[model samples]
Target: MHYRLICFDLDGTLVETAPEILDAVNDTLEQFDLPGVEQSQVERWIGHGTHELLVQALAYASGVEVQAVRAMPRLFAIGQAFDDHYARRCGTRGRLYPSVRETLYELREHGVRLAVVTNKESRYTQRVLSQHGLNTCFDRVVSGDTLPAKKPDPRGIEDCMRAFAVPPGRTLFVGDSSIDAATARRAGVAVWLLPYGYNMGQPIEACAPDRTIPSLASITDTASSSSSS
Candidate 1:
């Protein structure tokens, strides 16, 4: 492996979680007597964590603005309800992307340190990983609330590097959105984006990552590692 450490973004990059996320969002909206949001809307609302996504859904369903939804007197209760709904729906509709396990195993076999830095909160992150039998595949897991700031802040990536004593030059961040690309850039590390993951309905190439490989398997030596970090 050309890189010593590789960090992943959980939602779209590893797990095809939009379906479950949409289900949870709709479940919460229905419980609140508000209209449900579509999966397309939810996909665009992702990458910022569930709280923001919930707020967006509420705003849309209730015919209110995002700020108005946030200012609702029952906002706290609404968040709680969404959390409950999402917790139950964690892995119900999500699955690991193609070759995800194989690529991860190959990377580990080559002695590459793996980590997950996601905007997902800790509880949900744990459940999702565990549900997919991926809990032990990573060396570190950084959720949205794990540190002082989340992605695009560089703290999580920096924290991982510091813990592993790996330099930025030998680190790679793989994600499915511009947020991930920005996070890697802020941390001064190379980034690779996937074409199949959520990107707010935008093109992956628009994120300008170091590489836009077709899938996780594309990075393995046997699969076509034509480029290196």
Candidate 2:
């Protein structure tokens, strides 16, 4: 196989987490007497993590002016509250994407090393993985809070490569956003994208993934062959 390591983005790629995340966000907003965000808008605000999501959600909810929202000292309080709420609610309503488990098992059985690199807090990422019985599939997992930098920064990808002792040319990143593409570009790894994932309200095809597949299972054949080569 041409690739020695495979890394995945968590949120939309492997799991359908929109419902849970949206519920948690809306719950927090309601608690603060703030208006809730629409599901479509919430999809666009995701990928950056909870704090950024809340900031954007609040800005949208308030309609008070983006600059004004940034100036609000209470924004931090809201963010913290949202974090707590999400901690309790995340994964509750989410499920692994179709065929994700089967694909992961196939890749693992084929001797392909796997890892997860997500812009989610480590605790939350672990919680979701554990809930879905996916924690054991990956050789390593890197979360946004695990290091000083996150996706699109390339540091997380570099860390994954170092952890696996895999060269950049032999590593492949599977993700759902432009951030993943940017990280792959910076880290010198090949990237494949899933068409159904969230890409900040933009079309994921525009991110220019090397290959776009409809489901995780679609990569099983490729992964198996690549690992043997």
Candidate 3:
């Protein structure tokens, strides 16, 4: 299918941010005198957004349910600590997925507009993009805080479509989770999933993306002809 606009998810699709995020969550838990979780556990909590990750982390650390953690008087302060730690360490440990840079350049060369639609807040999104020298690759970036609601709502995808003047059929959302698939479905766009991203402990195939690709390099060939339809 030919597509003019290509939207990507941040955490798992484009970059592996689990390490830094996990470390920050652990750091916050330690600050509250709670036990830290395993990295594998934190990986399962990724792709939802920092707030959700922190909530889950707090719940896991304190051996309480998420609701209990939410009701705690120190939840706000703990959340702030997580936020601060993450802000300082966001891009320090993560690296772009293989072939991402090359594929993005190839897509841009083919005149396909690129944008990021992430559940991450804009504050850290910009930092990650700039840190990895990816700030120039995208034509637009829509963060979790940019809209009233996040993925599965389609608002961000719709906003990207409007910003790029692309129709649903001519747009594709590339991500690593069901949230991205749902977002594309609700926005009437095509979705392609990556096999190696965080899908909340489930296989990416369970997300039912239109296609599952091995790597970003594979998209270069498809994206070249994608504008012909």
TM-score of each: 0.96, 0.93, 0.95
The order of the candidates by TM-score, greatest first, is: 1, 3, 2
Global lDDT of each candidate: 0.91, 0.87, 0.87
- Identify the leading candidate in terms of lDDT: 1
Q: Worst lDDT window (10 residues) for model 1?
A: 220-229
* Model 2, runs deviating above 4 Å: 224-229
Weakest 10 consecutive residues, lDDT, candidate 2?
220-229
**Which residue pairs of candidate 2 clash?**
1-226, 1-227, 1-228, 1-229
Candidate 3 TM-score versus the reference: 0.95
Best candidate, TM-score-wise?
Answer: 1
Clashes of each: 0, 4, 1
For candidate 1, report its TM-score. Answer: 0.96
Alpha-carbon shift of residue 213 in model 3 (angstroms): 0.5
At residue 90, give the lDDT of candidate 2: 74
